[model samples]
Target: MTLVDFATSSLSVLPAIIALGLAIITRRVLISLGLGIIFGALLLTDFSLLESGKYIFNTVKGVVIEDGGINTWNMSIVAFLVLLGMMTALLTLSGGTRAFANWALEHIKDKRGASYLAAFLGVFIFIDDYFNSLAVGSISRPVTDRFGVSRSKLAYILDSTAAPMCILMPVSSWGAYIMTIIGGILLSHGIADYSALGAYVRLIPMNFYALFTLLMVFAVIWFKLDIGLMKEHEINAEARLNESHKEDEDHVDLHDEFGVEESEHGKVSDLIFPITTLILATLFFMLYTGNQALSSSELPFSVLGAFENTDVGASLCYGALVGLMFSLITVFKQKLAPKLIGKALWIGARSMFGAIIILFFAWSIGSVIGDMKTGAYLSSLVQGNIGLHWLPVILFILSGLMAFSTGTSWGTFGIMLPIAGDMAAASDISLMLPVLSAVLAGSVFGDHCSPISDTTILSSTGARCKHIDHVATQLPYALSMAAVSSVGFIVLGFTASVLMSLAASFAVFSMVIAIMKMLSKR
Candidate 1:
């Protein structure tokens, strides 16, 4: 085939490749994604500039209007995300988050305690990675800064816990969406109505990356184990604090420059009640939407069954709306003027504009990729290279790379899940769960480290840390976990026992951490 003919192939994944390259090179996700969308439109139009422009316009219009498949659910996610941004702004403006920080700082004595508290908050908010990143980073930044914990370290804790915890939890939005992908694949394979939830539950122990990533957060904190770039950042943070102390003895303030303004009247309950309401409302809306999604024949209802039927984006949107309403009521009760609350809400929504733009472009490229059958091409390419025994490890690595390049775990999941599911069903691999778990684990691992990832961005934004600094510091920690998890997946490929594999993986992680501790001492 000629060069032009080759480029026009139906399975071309060049648009995504170009997009990722642009993102990495320019460090501008929106521009990269927009370029990718343009490239995809051009490809669809056979390089006709006029047609490509029209195609691009239609794509954006459809995405915003929810006029087609996948975009509708995606638009709902965007709505909730904007609502969540508003909610976060209100919490910050109302001083609920600041009060919570004070409450945490009172008990958290020293840098180590502050780090653990930050990690704990990240773990606690498990509903959505976006929420987890925003809430934990904002809440923990003050306490972490109080004791000179690096913004990078604070970002690490926030990024590490967000997606990893979401993936491990079967009830979260991540789990629900993944289950749907698995269900579709299974149905295509003639396994009529297999329970994706049941499969996901069984695979939890197999998610070594998520498990190890969470544990490593504590291991690093407790052992004071700082390795690679993170170590340097922590040391520099201490040095800066000391320098400031000596230079301005009378002017020295313990508060971080990024610290939120405190409210003397703000109670811990101010933070707790609204957050609790958000979580509860999300679950309530999920279940309610799930119930409505089911057919009369499909349910007199079990929890998993309802989850399998759930409209993830719609539920999240509804939950966010409920949370926003409760937050307004709470702010009013706090004696904040209605106008102030309204202003805060608008400010919050405005803050999400950047994230919203990225999401739109991300979804656009995802649609392009889907239409091009890029995932299928990737699956085909990999299937020819690997034996069934090697499938789990290989898929893990491939999924990781895809997620790292794409900078959006959900988009990666949408691309890879069907491919992995179909491959598992077709191959003698017989162990689909391990492969699925690996995909989930790897996607999170990639997101944890990716400079362009939304969670990573939010973590830095939340901590008011330099974005590249957060990426640089978190990469070493993420790579450490990924190295250990890679070995764990290989072991699981051979043994195929989730419990035994988990135990073995945990042991491997401990050994790795022990070695790192010894090396750091040296």
Candidate 2:
């Protein structure tokens, strides 16, 4: 509210916005995010040339080292990503992907089915958005291409379902982060009419952005809607398929021989073991984090302490190591040289380099935003002006804008959750309903469109497609969902009835989509 605070907040946002603009124009997400971090650090240091270098170093160090370092949860993400890459490499080496693609081609054999499968996988991996994006992209890309689905469309499906689905799942990392922020807000306000945890659980079913995104994913699959970059991909795929078909038998066989030479297939056990280890490890991690087994432990350290100390990154790293070892054992048992295992590991690590760089930049940017107090400053400006009844919708929009501008959903939730919770408490609104919903909606909306968003970048990277092409093609879908969510919140503000809010939202969304389709045809 103070001029200084307003100026600082405004200044903090500039770097992120510039980064986004640069990303949009250049189609380089990591570089854009890195620039945003540098800008934020410089701004936070008051543009003092002498202090700017220190500020940037501190920012990076704080994220990568201090307080258990970026190796904590981020490392866990990297571990999973590395594991995914290894799995993908192994599948690729073993020709499992080709086999699966051939199997899919024999069955569904169409673009519609491929799209639906991709969407369904997105929904199925609801436990974590990071996992969903990587897994869906890696697994479905081949089949989708075989069926003529565009890489942009594939990216859209992967990005659409990632954060939105994770936000709705109570047991995921996204839920834990939101809950911590909400708990802080509730404790500060001394208003306890609604249970912060329970409310978020209830609101998940009614979150218009989350639900609408899922719907749009399905709609895209069902309708095979091709617009913008998606249309370009479609044209390319069709042309490639046609060209492949028209090639002379000898020429085609020669090309196929070269391609087939690179393909390898693993035994069934090779596939099952690593995935099983990953699932069990993830479940154990979740249970530990959730404190499900706290009462059973009587060690010097409390169960919570033990859980906290159990680094997700460390766990994942261990798991990946185990997976690599298992893969080697399998290969050796089959009398294959151990050198092949090294190649698999090298290929997996190589594939994950881009993801690792993006993750690092995302974390650095988040740290810069935290140091600048951007969220707190923004929250102060809107605290009293937005009424209790209208806070949800308003905060939803604010969170969305912040997230979109910063291109970081975690940063958006971290900043907005406390502020929204405080505002809701002060206005006599239920802390859970407005605060949690706003955080969820805002995070999803931001991730949906922010050119610097990691998932956005990964979605493009996974599809091997152009980044801006994906952003341009997916913008309309994200906005349509946002518009529907905005109307849903407005209705909820008046009625506060979950069923009615959701029904009205779905109805309105369907009507809008129908109208748009009709207009397009005309």
Candidate 3:
């Protein structure tokens, strides 16, 4: 039975709070998410046992099947994960991965070079976060592994760059979607001083968290600033390398998600060909889907329009499928028998099964959170009387908390942006850009630290790092950047100057890093 509707209340947040606490204490993602969903369902059903059971059963069912029809978007994402995993397995068996690793080992030289290579690749792929998180990992893992770079470090670099770069680059899918939201927000508020594209550009510099987080990635690498749990991870990776004492060409990475059985006839092209196909094919499908959407809609037929209208999950599935076929062909060329290829496919699919399960529950918890109107309840706290000068920083922190609890940055954006716009219009209309930008910045910061965040999950999956390890190691970095950005927003709220705030924020970040460096040395 469908539960009765309820108004937004403080009870909406209890499930998330309990879930977050349990996740921290137990480090078991599924248990935390499942309990959270149950708690949310119980609250929705008003303590009725049968109704709560139905509420939860329906939530899980709805992910794959909703309204008596297959929920293709969620299913497509699941399919894409399995397809990508299988493709990765095929590449490993083809010996292409080994050949590429050997080749990269000769050129990449040291851990520093390997770290930078991963960082740059993560930044280079900005079209979409999921693609960025997984693609960069496959390409860089061999080199990073060869040089004893910790998987946690690789995960951090991936997580930091994926969303930050996508949000910063206006040509990206994220840019397209966010611009669409801004356009409507602009029109609804009767503000026509700048076009949506123009306003997005203006908010770029004001996105302190995104800008600073990017800086922190490279800075940490360059300065050898391995703080918190990351330090222990790096040390362990180094010790493992020393203990193995194997030559680069002979070494098999224990940390690699792909198993150690590699073909003897594999070449670098085996790796290069399939990956190139995936990138090119995904781009083609993105445009195709976007154009198809624009053709039937009121929007003009342009690249931006297509991106803004694209079905991302479907595009990822089609591209991954094409890439999988190509990778299979590479494996077939090796002529290593049909059984092994089938074996590789099974192994690949199995590897992703655990992650996919976590993703399903995470999505369910998100759905539960939505039904409870948790975001609305949290946002209501901010709508009370407050000083105008503190709004930007307050909004930034609130958005971060909301995203952190909900495990969805996009959801935070949907709830907070309109409130920020309305507040800006009511207070100081000139502060509109700063306030809106804070929501974007804070959401990314929260997403970085959130265990249930999709990007966080995918980054660990790509890096083959344990999920808790990634979260634990990256927390210090995200928190530091957030601290710096917090003060910057405070400056912006008072002065209304993006330049001054950035200048002030940079000074604070520099000092914080220096202090961290000294502490690490001690």
Candidate 4:
């Protein structure tokens, strides 16, 4: 039953193609992924319809629950999601988010300041992308609304910062997950000299897309450069606010779960304490897990070294569980009814149900892709065609397409890193680092733009913006940064100097922002 040994070359890529085609045409990720899995199962069963049906049933079962599947990692994600959800809900019920917004409103005076504050808060919460998106939107949405900042804009700030910041911060969940994959790839390709953390650190400066994307947020805020559908949305939001009957205008429920109702019992500490605890616990557990693993391996133990050796899934689960406990204690101290807390926790977990289902299907499809060796097949197509001068940009473009099509940057990372590592084994470290950085940057770029992406969905939901509106308004900004990042990657491919590439990229970003500002005025 080792499908990789028996997979037909012709049918290997068909499932992925079908899945992408269906996603674009139908705009339903669950259905597209399900169909992809069924088609892949059929191919595995040699087109025997009856056996294919049975195989589909068994495959999904194994992928989700049985040993040697994605169950271990997938369940860790699930636990993290549920715990984070409960924390958000507890904060909401205690009115900590509203209180924080009110406190923030005292200092953040205008629309521009509000936008910058949102961006700052988004960047501040970098432990987890999901937490960043939800926390930024929930806390800053009210303040942004007070200053006539559109929901679309809020969503943009949240979405833009979430992944980019996480990918940039080595202490983040994203960093740990990606490093694990990269480490495996390096070991598998026989690159024994380089450690995963070392490689990741080297790739950081060359992460043009993330750096440019973060800069774009600041530029957009500072220059007030609203264009395309964003301009229309902002104008419309202002109009609605002006015509409001209430002078305070705090009762805006743009969506079911958004908007804040001020509560006298709410305290800013309620919000601050849980988040602080979450961060501390996450970092602590990461080191703790790393130390445990390292002790067994007889490796020299340092905090940074521990991170390189840590079990990311286990650490995340442990941190989330502890964070949940702290949040519950805070909520109980606020004298909220036990039943109400329980209800809020359930509601929060329920809210994550859709994300969990998408993750499940994503993992299932990944299993199929692994068996088919789809990434290897794609790697075969480019074996020696990519010259050193073009490798970085080419990898960027390929990773971008893959992530955009699949709507999962993590999946893109899983697929592309090994190929990049294998390429590196045949080449040099200078080439490998930049190419891997390109892959990481491009993955975030595509995820930032893809409407079907989980972060995109969560951001829109959190901001109470129309999902399509969020995508349409944010596309221009994302594409602009992507264009700049591409140029930077190209420069790096040729020069192999990180400093030169970064300077060139920043120059491009500045020029593009100036152009955008000029266009906005016209």
Choose the strongest candidate by lDDT.
3
Winning candidate number (TM-score): 3
Q: State residue 32's C-alpha deviation in candidate 4, in Å.
A: 4.1
Q: Give the Cα lDDT of each candidate.
A: 0.73, 0.67, 0.87, 0.77
In terms of lDDT, which candidate is stronger, 2 or 3? 3
lDDT of 3 by residue, 141-173 (tens): 877877888889999999999999999988788
RMSD of each predicted structure = 4.8, 4.9, 2.5, 4.2
Counting clashing residue pairs in each candidate, in order, gives 0, 5, 0, 0
TM-scores for the candidates = 0.82, 0.85, 0.96, 0.83
Arrange candidates by lDDT, highest first: which order?
3, 4, 1, 2
Against the true structure, candidate 1 reaches a TM-score of 0.82
Of 1 and 3, the candidate ranking higher by lDDT: 3
Segments of candidate 3 deviating more than 4 angstroms: 1-8, 245-260
lDDT of 1 at 354: 59
Candidate 1 lDDT score at position 83 = 87
Q: Write the per-residue lDDT of candidate 2 for residues 1-522, one digit (tens) a residue.
A: 111232434665677677778877777777877888777766666667668787777666765566764546665666667776766665555554666677778887578898888888888776556656766776677688777666778888888887788787765656656666666666777647656566567778767898888887887677655655566666676666667533321112111422322244444445456555555665566556445334345444443334333334554555556555554555555554446656765676666776677667777786666666666656666756555667678878888877777667877777777666656655665544655686678678978887767778777766656677788889988888888888888777777777777888888888867865654444
Q: Give the candidate order by descending TM-score.
A: 3, 2, 4, 1
The TM-score of candidate 3 is 0.96
Error of 2 at 474 (Å): 2.1
The better candidate by lDDT, 1 or 4, is 4
Comparing 2 with 4 on TM-score, the higher-scoring candidate is 2
Better of 3 and 4 by TM-score: 3
